[model samples]
Target: MRTLPSTGPRYEPPRPGSNGASPFLPPLPSSRTPIDPPDPIEPVEPIEVEPPPEPERRKLRVVDVQDRASLGGAALAGLSLTWVLYSRILPTEGTLGFIVCWWLSFTAFYLLLTGLRRGRVVLADRFAVLLAHSGAALVGIALATVIGYTLIRGAPALMHWNFFSQDLRTAGPLEPLSTGGALHALAGTLIQITMAIAVTLPLGVLCAVYLTEVGGRASRLVRSVVEAMTALPSIVAGLFAYVVLLISFGMRLSGFVAAMAISVMMLPIIARSSEVVLRLVPSGLREASLALGATQWRTVWSVVLPTARPGLATALVLGTARGIGETSPVLLTAGYTTYLNLNPFSGPMTSLPLFTFKMSQSPENNYISRAFGAAALLLVLVLLLFAFSRWLAGRGRSGAR
Candidate 1:
């Protein structure tokens, strides 16, 4: 207690006040200097984010065209070409120039349209491409038009009965040119074609069957040889027939010899066509047939053949068309006749093609007309054959299913 001398002020616990104040509290102190609230916190300025600069607007490209200049050039070119074509300055010159002009003009217009549609600057290069295509189309149209015009112009001469019913021997230029009918030629053609079909159909079908169904190394070699034969010239076939039948056998030139020659010509065509058609028959059919205990031959006969009958018929008709229209072989082997001859072996016979060729060679204009008529007839006949074949093929295909 000696040193406790002035220990600081004594502490005392505070007591609660009557107004719900805490008991442990100090009395309010008075100060001479005013107490200020702590300085107010500084406010942050809002961020001055300038909006992104307005996006630059994209500029649109403008197409500049010298319309008047292009059109004027085009018009001048067209007019010049027209003049040249119509004036006929040279042989077929007008036709050629007109064709060229039409193509150029069409091309120009096409390019102009394209450029306008695409909003592209019309340049000469674009026009050049258009012009090229136009030129090709014009050339094609010109050729077709010329041919049609020529054929139509020649039609009047072909309308007379004398054109189809007369032979050249009885016809003279001044005498209305009527003498013999095409009946003889028609008969010869039918006989030769019939014989050709008879020989070619069996041989061709067999060859096709062997190649497709029974083919082996030997069959491949045979097919190769046949393919090579297909390219042989009609003149060569004619010469061969002439030498073999007329000279070697001391046989008269007749429809029979012509038929044999034509058969040679038709064989490869028929064989190739038939082979392709037969091979196209699905292998599943053959397999199913065999699985049913059918022999290979039976499967081919009953299943394969029936399925491909249409194609086979088409091949035969095509072969007939090929043989019936032949002139060279028939000319060399059969020899032409004015009167009808039913016998294939005894005398010279004329076919439609041979008749046309002979008629066209005569000096009389009537003969020329007759040649045209014969040509038209022959064309019609072949077309009918094709139509019939197609019909048969359709029926066969439907029936097979």
Candidate 2:
């Protein structure tokens, strides 16, 4: 207690007229005393920022003036050098040889000029483009040459109207172009091909459906067999038909037998090609169809087949093209005949290819002209069939959309 110095500030009671308050609490702050205001906020100056620079635009050109100039210079130089070489250095005498030499020289000159003008990467790109273009040009030139040659050789026979209406029955190997026609061969071709298609179409489509929509171990085996048959020689197919139908089954040789042989060749083509087309049908369509409570077969029938109709037509065309041009198969299965026979199962028949082959063997200008004419006719017939198929496929597409 030794005068416990005042441990706390002395507590004072409220004075009169003062509001009553607790004495133990600290005194309230006096309102009259000056209080410093918060320092005035400074208005911030906004910073000016520069936008990032725009990326440079690159110009793409297929062939600029510089490229055209280089091509012209290279071509001119190559031609001149090749001419000099062929005349003064090389012993080449043919037009074909000259063209080949020119092409090689042109390519060499092109590479040299491009290398001098550009870097390695650009040089490689240009060279690749050149090769692609050159390949296309060569193909075009070859095709044009073949067509022109065929036309020139066939023009004399094709000029006769009766060449399409009459038959070789009465026309001899030395007969004039106006005497004989390809009617019998044309009719036989149509009948045989029609029969082959009738036998192969449903079988091929079903096989494709089985392979694509209901794949299994059996499908794999079937696929392997189809692939093998795709490579089966035409002669082998004819021999198979010959042995199985003509020898073993006692079936007579006729257009019907030829149809069977053609069917053997066409079936694998249609099946394999159609299977590829069916596979291209989107899986999303199948899934959506299944989601809507359709069964697998129903989905494939309703969605997949319709969707791939155009490609199926193309496959059919391919098969037809393959079978129609076959010479050995028709020669072996359908014996050559000059008279028109409507019944495929009755008499010997001949197709366009067979007719052409037979006519070509005769040592006469008329026969040779007839052969060339038949070939041209075959080409035209194929073109017509292709166009018709394309039209039908286009119709399917428009209807689908």
Candidate 3:
């Protein structure tokens, strides 16, 4: 008899546990497996069984848990050595020196222990990271101490409301904080900064745009001048204003002159910082805009500037901070006055820095307190500016989105 034509592999049932069985279950009975003989042409197929997974890896730690007790012992030894060196072993008298010495010793000891446990390579990496963290912590501690000390010293004068609303002109150095305030100085600072910002913002931003987007032979010269001005002495800026406005033209010392000097000082900072911000704007955005047939100016105005607006605002605030805290420039150009002068062209106007200097120069303790209070107010004003900038930047970013 003739056999039917072959189709494909013949259907055969899987052996027991050939499909991966649960590890928790007992082994299947051998009787369940098929024991039928196979045809000659259909070969036996081999089953693939995957091996068990390897265990998880653990990272090398800078400090091992097992060595925690040793770490504490090392720290104690370092601290004791530092105290001894600061107190009797060395000529130093400061707790700061002691802290520095202690930290150094602790770091060195920790590294030595790490090297002993791990290896030289791991020790080096750990040492570098530890050093960086220590430096940052030291900086934070220094700032906290300085700000705390200032707040403590100025608390007396700052408690009075009159100090925020009055000027040093009306109050004598011997007068109490209730009578004479830093109001006039506050007004002057506000006026000068306003003028400087008004003048500097447009000019600085344009110069930055020129440098980044339209770089050329002329731009290089401009960049060089701007860079040179970054190191321009505050005294030189003051003298330049004095010679140009007072000596040459016989103009009086006024807020206008002071603002001009401050503007000169602020311009370079704003320009350079804005340039950096603008440069950081991704080139892909610019290229995409141009590909859509938008002009260079249009791309910058619509895409680039808006994207970089927050950063540019930060640049402006930094420049304002630099100009606002200056003493020498305001001293030479604004002159010292106690009265509130709204006009930028006439009357000598004083800033917080100048007011603080004058107050501290006196022999009275009250004046010194007021001086510290003025400093505290200045810090608050700067903080306010920074906050305002941040708010504005947030708003702009939201609007863009």
Candidate 4:
């Protein structure tokens, strides 16, 4: 390569300690540069943040004052409108018709007011509540009226002490209320029901057990038959008993035969109800029992039966209620009699239902009073049975605890 000629004087780097320092020399401190103290770290006080204010608590209440006010307003409006329509606009009406119209108007006005004040959700809820309350109220009113009317109509006969002590054997349709009592009818009813319960309870519970614990094709068949029997009319049951025992076997009408007829009605009811109750028993219990090496029979008898005792009592009550009020079967099988017959195996028996029916057919006021009195007694008996069942159920619950 050939050298080229320079254009000007050549550049030279400065020596060490001169205007610039050499790269090999160590760095030197400068007095002009200020040295600041390290930043002072002031202690930060803990943040004194107050806890968020506790939310105000409000107690929830059912049926507030506003609800009561709204209800009163609706009732007043409904009653006023009903009175105006019935008295001024309508041609004629009875108490029942006016009451029904007032109820309809009240419900409509209440729903309208609720929808206006609240929204659709609240309106729907209020409507549902109102419907439930109205249905319960109507049921209560109907029961009260029936009981009140029955007691009022039967007061003349019920007030007499002898009406419960004597039988209709010495009494006539024209006889005074004090002359005779429903002793025979009462005895017959008690005896028949007792016998029916005795015959049906064990069999029904066993059938239920078989259906629940030993379910098979046979169980399904039995269940079908039981369901069919539940719909069997009282008259059909009566007719069957009349045909089989009376016609075929030459068995005479007696309380025993009446009990047999009643059993036909009671058996299916008890079985079906017991089956439902048994099905409600937890499978866990059965598994636990089996795990403990208890046999199936022992588990059912000791564990299952005791656990379902209260429900079984309920089943008993149901069967008793169905059988006790049966008139057609008793009339067909027992052949009603006015005279008191203590022996159920031999003679005709007079039950409360039969006595009520017979007395109601008579034209005499005294007879009608007796009929009503008998009917009232039947109601009392049913109440007693219900109370007894509840007592038994409560006892079982306490025992379990």
lDDT of each: 0.77, 0.88, 0.85, 0.87
TM-score (C-alpha, index-matched) for candidate 2:
0.77
Work out the TM-score per prediction: 0.69, 0.77, 0.75, 0.77
- RMSD (Å) per prediction: 26.1, 19.1, 13.9, 22.4
Give one digit per residue, the lDDT tens place, for model 2 in 1-401: 12233343544554533655566676666565544555544545445567678798777765678788989999999999999998678777888888888989998998898888788998999999999998999899999989888878888988999888998989998788889898898898899999999999899999999999999889889999998989999999999999999999988879999999999989999999999999988899999999999998899889999899888988898789778888888888899989988899988998999999999998999999999999888888887888878897778777764
Q: Per-residue alpha-carbon lDDT of model 3 for 263-301, expressed as tens digits?
A: 988888899899998998999999999999999999989
Residues 112-212, candidate 1, lDDT per residue (tens digit)? Answer: 65566554544565666556765798799897776564456446545556555554456454455345556678778989899988999999999999999
- How many clashes does each candidate structure show, in the order listed? 7, 0, 2, 1
Query: In terms of TM-score, how similar is model 1 to the real structure?
Result: 0.69
In model 1, where do residues sit more than 4 Å from their true spots?
1-93, 112-169, 172-174, 177-179, 396-401
Mark the 10 consecutive residues where model 1 has the least summed lDDT.
Answer: 1-10
Tell me the spans in candidate 4 whose CA falls farther than 4 Å from its real position.
1-54, 57-67, 88-90, 104-128, 215-217, 281-296
Ranking by lDDT: 2, 4, 3, 1
